[model samples]
Target: MGKPAKNKEVKPKRNRITFETKAKIIKLKDEGKRNSELAKMFGYSTSTIATIYNAKSKAIVQRAVEECVPQGVCVFKTEYRPTVLNDLDTILYEWFKRNEGRKVALTMTALQCKARSIFAILMDPAHGIF
Candidate 1:
């Protein structure tokens, strides 16, 4: 007897938007665009756009973007997780973007290996980040 195959669908991975994007959203909204239009443009749900638009810290986000730009830094999140290494996150994200832009296929094992290598190099005594 043959086993039946399980029917399941896989969804694309979702990425978190950056503070610069949030600032742009706020600016566009101030220019008279509606939430639905922004949502469609940003590939998010209308509710999400509305949430960003209605969030009380809109000015704060704008300020963060302006302040971080000249300093060559970014506000990745409202709260930082102690275990996360910011440099690792930035490097990994840039790596992902570069490869993805070239249409390269990335898998979990490849990503894990890359992260291990990056962490090793970054933690080395010779690395300037130290």
Candidate 2:
């Protein structure tokens, strides 16, 4: 007996849109052709043709619209703002001047202590915190 017939069948491949088709779509859109007609001419769906038309139609108009507007002119204030460092500069200067020992340096532990002290001073409203 002959072998059982195969159940699977090969499906035809979908066609890719070429550059010529894209150019034709753009040309037709620029010429004000209807999206439905363009779809028929290019063997594409109406929605696909509409998308292409909309994208192409917006390209130049978008660029023109973006170009016509001038960017806003910003004025920056260069005044120096007092900060926590400014508040502590006097106290820190006095501390450094009194502890002028050659071994004095900003080690990690000293940095942490300084940071905590600064935080405390900043939190104290009567200390003229920034």
Candidate 3:
């Protein structure tokens, strides 16, 4: 006899609004369009339109769009990460740009290896990898 199958929990899909749409919503609102009107036009609820229209920082929203960041990510959170490798990041960025300029493409594995080697070299001599 087989045991009963466990019910799987399904996560709801997130509906991400693009930056352009958000900007349009704000522009329309500034032009005296009501939340309900904007909602109907954009196919979202009134609250959703109102939230974007009334966001604290419009610049953050615009910047996120220009950078291709998802809508739900906070701008401040994206600005900095406490655990970032500053020196390694600078090295990687320059390496990537140089490769791109030379028309040399690197695969994910190659990039990973490069990153690991750089990280190893930057590590303190007292705490060398075994």
Candidate 4:
């Protein structure tokens, strides 16, 4: 196989249970859907359904689904974001939480800018960011 590009994020596996999918699975479970049913519906495994569903999972799922879980993603990730880009996850989530319930429209460019700012703030040696 050819070497993967250094700059490109690896695409998620076709069946990887993303946070948005987790939210749906959790909702289905709450609505009395069975694990087998969910596994069949989402084309993932039962264990994946079970693992991402739990009492404590609501909080993380909440972060992941903050803004309706856009088609291109917009939040925290356990199984969603690439590990290398998640060094500032906490900061990013905090920003999301801070802006929760507000009608702040986030364009792709805005999100990219935010990510860059967060990266700069976190990686800045002086830590004196404005």
Candidate 5:
């Protein structure tokens, strides 16, 4: 019998933005600029910028509490699990309540802060960044 061919592994496409860059993107986005404008400003693909807007990754939620979460209030680990987002939401919602302001601005600020850090995590694997 002929030898079977080896299966090829396909890697997911890497995003150009790192978690740190995402933090910047989030900050820019919170300042009330459009995604197209932000993309042009940062030289990132509009679609990628849009992804940051949509908030798909759970890592942002995790990073959101890294600084603000009270000492011994919460702890984060490097493990990836399905329920992490739900827990993160609870933590973040509490954060939201603590920082009261116009709902729109507050939400924007939270999203931007977390997205910036989250973007960095996303890029670390592919771009050799933090």
Candidate 6:
């Protein structure tokens, strides 16, 4: 008795449809191209094409198209939100800039100690160190 050999066909790598591609798909749809046609043309699912075509806000579509230049792509509703630590981030950035090119840069432990001290100062009402 002999065991059957398994098929060894290698699968092709799945390609991500980039923001630029999505913008292009929306543009083609605006030009009266059908979802089926777009799916075949862009190698994406019909549902994906339809979603891009039928997005509720025209402003969002326009922004995507405008942002699809050579340098970078624009994503809708994905802007960075400011957190409570924003001030801390700014302080750390300034500290790093000031210490740049120094022979003895701040170690992780020193940075942590500085951050903890700053946090304590911010938290203490008596200090008024906001």
Top model number, TM-score: 1
Whole-model lDDT values for every prediction: 0.76, 0.64, 0.74, 0.69, 0.65, 0.68
- If scored against the real structure, what TM-score would every candidate get? 0.47, 0.32, 0.40, 0.37, 0.35, 0.35
Tell me how candidate 1 scores on lDDT. 0.76
51-91 per-residue lDDT for model 2 (tens digits): 76667645455445435643221222242223555556766
Candidate 1: the clashing residue pairs are: none
The lDDT of model 3 is 0.74
Which residue pairs collide in model 6, if any?
Answer: none
Candidates sorted by TM-score, best first: 1, 3, 4, 6, 5, 2
lDDT tens readout by residue for model 5, 49-130: 8888677354487567545664333264544232445545665666666666545456576667875565454334454344
For each of the candidates, give the backbone clash count: 0, 0, 0, 0, 8, 0
Native-to-model Cα distance after best TM-score fit, residue 22 in candidate 6, in Å: 1.3
74 Cα displacement, candidate 6 (Å): 13
- Candidate 4 structure lDDT: 0.69
Off by over 4 Å in 4: 1-16, 55-130
Error of 1 at 40 (Å): 1.6
Model 4 C-alpha lDDT per residue in residues 6-122, reported as the tens digit of each score: 897887666544566777888899899998999999887888778777643664756646556543343555545633356677777777766665868767787778888987776
Instruction: Give the 10-residue window scoring lowest on summed lDDT in candidate 2.
Output: 71-80
- Residue 89 CA error for candidate 2 (Å)? 74
Candidate 3: the clashing residue pairs are none
